[model samples]
Target: MKTAPARPEAAPAPAPPVRRARARRLLMCRPTTFEVSYAINPWMDPAVPVDAALATAQWERLYRLYLALGHQVELIEALPGLPDMVYAANGATVVDGKVLGARFRNAERAAEGAAYLDWFRAHGFTEIHDPLHINEGEGDLLTCDSFILAGWGFRTAPEAHREVEAVFGRPVIPLELVDPRFYHLDTALAVLDGDEIMYHPEAFEPRSRALLRRLFPDALLADRADAEAFGLNAMSDGLNVVLPRAAEGLARQLAERGFNPIGVDLSELLKGGGNVKCCTLELRAPALGQ
Candidate 1:
């Protein structure tokens, strides 16, 4: 009888939007000796002077910001002669504590790669995969929600993708980059969440661009302007995103989605062809039951 009033059917609860868990633990290197002594990518111009003190100060601000956000910031000691070492994302990629060492393509950065691998080994990444093929670490390899996205036709070799799949025990989707500007995958695309991606199509080949659309049907399309400012090279911690000061469009877009965008001036490091994501590496830990 108490149930006789059969409470009006409760409204069905709205389904939660699918999202990739935000990264909290990250790896970063101090720009103790960063400078643009040589040009590796298009964005790097040796003629353009870089202020080492300014770069160090900017990087300090970023590191402090990550800490202020309650993120675990790991470090690899800053060594002399490794001017580009500040772009820690390029050193190596960590997937569930499994380290995939970088086999850098250029000799100038070769030592930097080895230094990173050494640090990983000394720091408890036991399952280190010394690369058999040249791969530029997280700059080209990114762990999207259920799978890994590999970028080639630039720094990382296609062969490396297969090795990554075998090592990580996950499906690896290879996307080819066509433009030199977006030399690294991190420079062209940012995984906003599990199902949402932000990218600039001009950086990718038509096939890869089409594949991105098919894979992420609701991807956010970005323009060359955004790419120029390295908008896609942003680091997200679920609720907040750290991006370049010049990426106003990306900041607004993220703000509309309820994300707090923290912009920083990484222009000094940009002389070596990198930005926010470039300085940060998300080191994922092992999943439960591992």
Candidate 2:
């Protein structure tokens, strides 16, 4: 039988273009009350004087930059005695209009943690799941596309991973952070988008490192200098990545991967042991169907 002329081999379907801005709505707290008054993490030293005004100015610059990029930047009122409240990402891990409230391990930030849960409640997040385990909110719970990458063994509890998985209806991969400098997942890892991540290998345990490698074969490894500069504490709008001004190596690597790295000076905030991502928490409204 004469073979029907081979149909022109069907062209492989084009891969969907990577998008930025999937995590555009952000919740930020002003360094209006930011101060390194007490030591919590290794980055903080009570003896080192903090410039609150400069911190405010730098925070404003970062906030305005986010606004200029057309992202929703919401704010939380600063309360007295909560110096670390400026690290908004530690407040809560919000997804699908549900909040996994943070149960802070540190007594200093405990109240600030309560305030975050209340904020979620007042703002119409009805399904707030109280933590049975200590979790410093988005500080350890990094939301990727269909799953949440959770880090424990330092700041957060591994049990929080199971809670996150149940509450968010997403898989939660628990990675153990071994380095004191990278106490929180945000400090050692930056989720670029759904399919890719950039992280510091030495900060994680050997098993966690291997898990990261397997889970994210396309992961970008942050250089030691960049990691030490808190470079992994970066934020992405899908296209533009807002990061520390000192992380030039990371910025270049991001550029190579087709991401626009907008470096901003968060040195003042760094005194508090956080940077751009630390100061910002992404808000995914229920309407987004996250």
Candidate 3:
């Protein structure tokens, strides 16, 4: 009788890739005068009472968290009349030391663009473009690895996408937003790392959804509950992800991908139709020696 051949040992499961958190220079504003006085988007309701104190408290925590995470936090003095200035991400879009100033669609936020541009000028940013077309800054224009993902059918005009491409010297892919609730692209989608993105499909038009699928096949799909919770309005420093605390489902998905998701209670700020990413403006590659 011949001895049976021994079976080969099974290979061990591969370890997940370790995520690295890169320090970022972020700009934010204190929500000292935050209010829902005007209905700019679906989230804002004048009938609903806003706790200005609570909004300030929540924003402070987020600001401190950024500092604790080894990120540089810069403050822009909030103007008295502009209640929506707290959404600093709407002020401007900075990339590779180039600044493309925002041009708001609604008159309510018109002055915010100049206010942010002033800060950049004071800080020694020379390559700044005051856009001719209407754009909502980082609110509708998000940077991927080598290109920019622009949003339209809401606040930002399609023409602004071309302006951004010309200003940043990168290809811009425009995605049309269909749902009123997800007015800003930042509200419906988030850039996790490099070209990795997560978004809610229903927020985008059918054609835009198809485009997103083609571009990022492995993108995380958020459920309605998470999307409504403003889960997709998240900020990532390559590894650590800061998002709304209500987005528990999305947090778990991020953890599975080897990310550290820091959930924060920005419910007070949500009343103003903004959250984590809305309050954060990343100043990418500021002019050296300035």
Candidate 4:
């Protein structure tokens, strides 16, 4: 009998694309114990100086807001009396078992990277990387389960976006910010639940606006007055939101819609050029199969 023919070997299956795990634990800096500045803009002269009394009160309010939202807030030790280094949330984004520390384009804030690196290592985040030539941070990025939208212009550089794409092994949708007044993406755009987004049209170019509309067709265009008043593009947890106390009406509306709004009075912090989302960093969620 003839020997049986050798069976054809099956080709190895292609590797599955990596999926970012859902964020569960977040890192937020405590303003009560930290020295921060709010003299971010003089041209606009729009922000109020944060005295000790005002800063204390605002910290209390922000702390309460975070607690009410049910997040396990880890207050990192204040950075060695660095008054201007307290804006921690603008430093990084954690996803898919990796930490992408920010490369701040602003020379005034370049020290932010070192501060964040210490925090990341202290928290046991080993997989970390950043762009060599450009500065980028969470302020320029909006990450979902599927993709990351990177805003490039005043705050985040084009080279930084490319670095993010390379590290995450995913596409980084580039958006050009037209208005310098907005400063960062978080100042003018926010991705709410589902495909709904909240934005200020004036902050973006016509091309960027068109792209945003296409990406989030159901986006809610908030009045510029409301957006500006409340820091509408600030950070959110999907289930809850932290906003300026002045946004009482918006908070109520969100509450009625099944979202828990934790309103914090960040007038002092905003004076320094940031709000709730600007002062904390969310670490990566535990990877699947962990």
Best candidate (score: lDDT): 3
- Give lDDT tens digits, candidate 4, residues 159-222: 7777888777768888888766677777777765544457777888889889888877756565
TM-scores of the candidates are: 0.91, 0.91, 0.94, 0.81
lDDT of 3 by residue, 1-290 (tens): 99999999999976656889999998999987788899989999999999888899999999999999999999999998899999999999999889999999999999999999999999988999999999999999999896799999989999898899889889999999999999999999999999999999999999999999999999999999999999999999989999999999999999888889999999988998999999999999953684
lDDT of 3 at 250: 97
**The 10-residue segment with the lowest total lDDT in model 4:** 15-24
Off by over 4 Å in 1: 1-23
Better of 1 and 4 by lDDT: 1
Q: Candidate 2's residue-wise lDDT over 1-290, tens digit each?
A: 87788778888865545555653788999877788888889999989988888989999999999999999888899898898999999999988778888999899999987898878888767888888999999999998886799989878888778888889888888899998999999999998877689999999999989999999998889988999999999998788899998999999988878888999998988988999899999887775533
Query: lDDT per prediction?
Result: 0.86, 0.88, 0.94, 0.66
| Per-residue alpha-carbon lDDT of candidate 1 for residues 1-290, written as tens digits (9 for 90 to 100) | 35565668889865545333354888899988787788879988888878888888989999999989889999988789888889999998888778888988888898988899898888877898888999999999878787788999989999999899988898998999999989999999987666567888889889998888899887777778878999899888767778888988878877766667789988888888999999998888988889
Candidate 2: segments with Cα more than 4 A from true spot: 1-19, 287-290
Higher-ranked by lDDT: 2 or 3:
3
Q: Which ten residues in a row have the lowest lDDT in candidate 2?
A: 14-23
lDDT of 3 at 68: 97
lDDT of 1 at 49: 79
* Clash numbers, per candidate: 0, 4, 0, 5
What stretches of model 4 exceed 4 Å from their correct place? 1-23, 32-48, 252-257
Residue 233 displacement (Å), model 1: 0.5
Q: By TM-score, how accurate is candidate 1?
A: 0.91
